[model samples]
Target: MGRIAAGDGESYARSISTSSNVEIRRRTRVTDIAQRVAKLMWQWAAHIVRRKDGRWGPKVLEWQPRTGKRSVGRPPKRWTDDIKRVAGIR
Candidate 1:
């Protein structure tokens, strides 16, 4: 294109910032609140999955014992493993 800076230096080219908006907590945006809730839920899910025995929500999420041996490498991936990967959980 002829115009190299067509969208440059223009506020319209920028996405809306969540921090600038006020939420019910008065200091955060709705997305922030939702994110906090989601993280908390994920943490709680980990806790639930750690239970020894139960048919609760997270029990299904947790990986189960392997009837056979695994290869000489990292274990097979689980849904919770992926969640932890994206959520930055330990």
Candidate 2:
């Protein structure tokens, strides 16, 4: 094992194998690529849904309850106004 300086200027211990380090780096890259692809897929799916019904789809935006506020278990439904505008819905 070896210690390396982290972004926060703290030394963290990690495995000393070169192969392990390479695998970790590869996994990180793969995760980033997956995230990008997922975002693109979501946008395409949302576009298709909106085009089919002239209305925003369920996945376009999600509503979350206000922080530190009491409310029902389900958060209020909301739309992404920005996305709506981009989609020229309204």
Give the candidate number with the greatest TM-score. Answer: 1
Candidate 2 lDDT, 8-40, residue by residue in tens: 333233232435744876866655665677578
Where does candidate 1 clash, by residue pair? none
User: What is the TM-score (0 to 1) of candidate 1?
Assistant: 0.34
Model 2 Cα displacement at 11 (Å)? 14
How well does each candidate superpose onto the true structure, as a TM-score? 0.34, 0.26
* Deviation from native of the Cα of residue 86 in model 1, angstroms: 1.3
* Residue pair clashes in candidate 2: none
In candidate 2, position 56 carries an lDDT of 50
After superposition, which runs of candidate 1 have C-alpha atoms over 4 Å from their true positions? 1-19, 22-31, 56-59, 62-90
- lDDT per residue for candidate 1 within 5-84, as digits (tens), equals 66663543353344345543464324566778768877877687677675666656755857886788887787677677
